[model samples]
Target: METSERIAQRLRQFGELEATTSPLYRRLAPLAAARPELVALLRERRSGQPPANVLLAALQRRLMARPEAPLRGYFATLGGTRAPDDELATAFDAFWPGELDALAGLVRTRRVATNEVRRAAVLRLAYVAVARRLVERERPPTAHLVEIGASAGLLLAWDRFAYRYGSAGFGDPDAPVTLTTTWRGTVPPDPHAPFTVAERLGVDVEPVDLDDPEAAAWLRALIWPEHVERAAAFDAAGAVVRRLGVTVRAADALTFLPGGLDALPGGLPAVVVHAFTVNQFSDAMRRAFDQALGEAARTRPIYRVGLEWAPGGARLELTTYPGGRTTLLARADPHGAWVEPLEDEPATTSR
Candidate 1:
């Protein structure tokens, strides 16, 4: 192979390696540190190679290119309260050299994402795309959107901030937090359309409150680092949520979904959306959810979009029905990367 191709391949391989975001590093610090020496011991004791080196490589690569000042500045100023912890950053630097060399070797040689991580990544990205498409066709007359995992319900109001989508940007780029979207193909809907949100109601086992600065910060930190857009989106979303706020309660999607009709009397005239959450259930659970959602959708004109990671990268599928019957509108890659259409114009079914 040519030198350039080889180098590109190596870089791609490196990119695939899972690096820690500030929150994740904190979570895994104890685990990674505890298992530091287990690599050699396991290799000797087990029949296969161990994962210690792989972990180290991820740490090293991230640190080597680490823009300490930018990262810190991002955290301190624009990153919200939850950007990243200094101690965690320090720990990563200290551990990088030895661990990363081994890990980098593994990333280039034995590069493969485990089934679970791959699935998670796919699912997350798929949902991310679907979320952006919420305003497609025409931004709703009222932008009030319904969210499922309203953890803190912080993102319920995402319409108010800046969104940077390469050529198709939304919101204010100069805002404290911005979701950067690198447009791969046609862009999703614009936020400036006729949509005006009246409400944001979220349901989570435990929801984050925008009023609490620490909780908000924690939420930012918890977002995956590689998906930089998630953090920026969250900030704009959080801010919007504060302005629109959210009426979040501890509830399950299956039960509350149907019952929610009462809260949205005259039936909501807005696009209702659910993303990345279908996988939270087993197949049976998913089936039951679809069934329940189908039944509830009968009450109003509901546009349904689904994102499933499955075992592959990710598939952003849109299913919009005017009423009961539904059809897959278009499937796309995360962030409008590529759209796969099974039908033209979103399928609309009415009772």
Candidate 2:
């Protein structure tokens, strides 16, 4: 296939996601379509990479952070919280070409590094919605959490942020930020119920430190330009992680799972959680992880919770060790803005 066709295909997926999940990207989509030259430029930069948005994300990060940049005026959060849609679109039409040129220079000079926005806390909230049921089933007073692809370990501090879905609520009452998602389908387990995290640790190839300006900027860039609430939530979560001093080891998930499980304190239920991470692993690596987890289950009580995508949507699944029974708990938006609870537990072949 031609490079533009390949890039357009990827952009179409991003466009659909933006239409469903982001207000900002939805508005920018038209501009992206109108300018074939910009698409050609992005295609050239992306080469054969599937994630064409990386170039735009880097450009947005640079533009948003720089006070004097022309695009800075168009951002709602930067100058004002509101702008007319037509005006914004006009501004985009005028500004995108020059910014794309600058982006080309930035890409050539190696000023920005590629990174994905890891908002695992959204998944954490999805987990918490049904956590009481899991806790009741396992009958464990304390839960030890080990995360794969933990990124900046922001979600490790999930308990520090407040959550409210419809009328149900969870997390610290006094927390600075509150994450609200629409509830669909059946009600989730009681969010007010008690739970404890005795230990939490994350494993990733390269862990982010919020203290590093560049690293933090990349993360902020990962957020779509319009989702100011998400950016705010991330800042609040980052503060909590920094204050609490969460540990995120620099290691591969498959290699770390076995040893990490073995080192957990005995008697407490060890819960391993990962979201939108496992699919990136090689088939061999995934098999090794499953094998490792199965072996570790022999030593102690272990439960695996995965928030992953299925053919239908993003589903939450729980796997209990010893006998390896897995149950589907809920389905959610890709960003966890809404969750539809499953009334009946359905067994799945995959996590």
Candidate 3:
């Protein structure tokens, strides 16, 4: 794709994402449409790479709750419930050439990474859906959980978050954070179904450390300013991670998964979970990872639960070891805000 097209592509993508997920970002969409210079700066800033997600990578970084940024106070006010649409529009309209120029400079020099929001916390909703199916199928005595692309290992701690979907509820009733989403179709899964997690391990190419203030700040910045609830959830999840002493190793998924699966003790049920992660891998790498999973399945059962984008919707899929049969379990919102279970479960399938 040409540089201009790539720039326009990212802008449109983020704009669309904001249209659904964030009112503040939706309000600011005109700025992107009106200013071609923003696209040029992002395109030219990173010469040979996919266009930088300047909104998350650069602008949010400066506005993040960091002591050094003078704009932190501004961010705090806007992040609050009192934040009005007019004020938000004014903020963007006023930022213009000055703030935008600085943001462009940051994109050029600061090495801003894409959002690894590690939003697996909410994905627990999907996990619960799969877990109930697992209980019905095999009822594994215990599950050894492994997560790929588990930045900060937050999702590995899904068991810690409370969830309420319609009348169903799961996890700790007294959990600090609660995720509630309405059911879309089919009866909701039994949230009270029993499952055990024996161990949790996670791998990421560059894992964030919740304990490190700077690293934690970056994770917070990944949340769009308009999504105040998500920002609060990140903080709540981080605190839980620290309190629980969760740790994720810095390793690429391609190299980590095979070994991670190989080391799992035999006889115990093993499950690998990845939410919006494997899609980042190249076609060859994805095939190689699948091949490795197949090899491991020959030795022991490994249930793979994945939430990924499809042409129709975000799909929740399950794959069992040995034959590596997969099932389309549900279609969910990317953030797990809603899950619509398949009315008639498909036969064992593979993608």
lDDT per prediction?
0.46, 0.66, 0.65
Query: Worst ten-residue run, lDDT, model 2?
Result: 109-118
- Compare the candidates by lDDT and give the number of the best one: 2
Clashes of each: 21, 0, 0
**Which portions of model 3 miss their true places by more than 4 Å?**
1-20, 27-41, 44-52, 65-106, 109-140, 191-194, 343-346
Deviation from native of the Cα of residue 234 in model 3, angstroms: 1.5
**Candidate 1 accuracy as lDDT:** 0.46
Model 3, range 1-351, lDDT digits (tens) per residue? 356656766667666764565554554554565567777677646544434344444666655534444333345423444343446545654554666766776666533333323345335544555566566777654678888877777777777877777887777889987767667766656544435678778878888787878667656665666666666667777788789887688888877766677776767767788878888778999888888887777766777888887766687777777677777777776766667777435445755
RMSD of each: 11.2, 4.2, 4.1
Clashing pairs in 2: none
TM-score for each candidate, following the candidate numbering: 0.55, 0.80, 0.80
Per-residue C-alpha lDDT of model 2 across residues 1-351, encoded as one tens digit per residue:
366665565666666664554566656654565567766766445333434356556567667656765556656545535443667766666666666666665443322222222334345543553456555676655678888878888767776777777776776778876778777856554444434688899888777777888677767776666667777777777777889898989998877877778787887767788877787678988788777888888887667777776766687777767566677767877677777777445456544
Give Cα distance to truth, residue 324, candidate 1, Å: 4.7
For residue 137, give model 3's deviation from the true position in Å. 7.2
lDDT of 3 at 100: 75
